[model samples]
Target: MPHLEEHVSLRPYNTFGLAVQARYFARFTSAEVLRQLLALPEV
Candidate 1:
């Protein structure tokens, strides 16, 4: 991952097209990093 914190937000999403931030949030450049990101407590 270039940066794990990229695109993360505490602000209310300005759209109703999605469910929630954490519900669809993810950041990783590879499967290995994806596994690590999915394990995060905040994921």
Candidate 2:
């Protein structure tokens, strides 16, 4: 499974540096991996 993370902060990713949270966060290397992650219930 992809390295799934919940409630991940978006501050570093944000250009404005605002404290935002993502309900779910994951990085996929390929389309198949992305499909797998998207298949998860939480996604």
- TM-score of each model, paired residue for residue: 0.39, 0.85
Error of 2 at 31 (Å): 0.8
Question: How much is 16 displaced in model 2, in angstroms?
Answer: 0.3
Positional deviation of residue 20's Cα in model 2 after best superposition, in angstroms: 0.7
Tens-digit lDDT track for model 2 on 1-43? 7788999999999899999999998878899999999888877
Q: Where does candidate 1 clash, by residue pair?
A: none
Candidate RMSDs in Å, in order, are 5.6, 0.9
lDDT of 1 by residue, 1-43 (tens): 4345644553565564553444345546788888877777665
- The number of residue pairs in model 2 that clash at the backbone is 0
Tell me the lDDT of model 2 at 33: 92
Tell me the lDDT of model 1 at 30.
Answer: 84
Give the local distance difference test score of model 2: 0.89
Model 2: residues with Cα > 4 Å off, grouped in runs: none
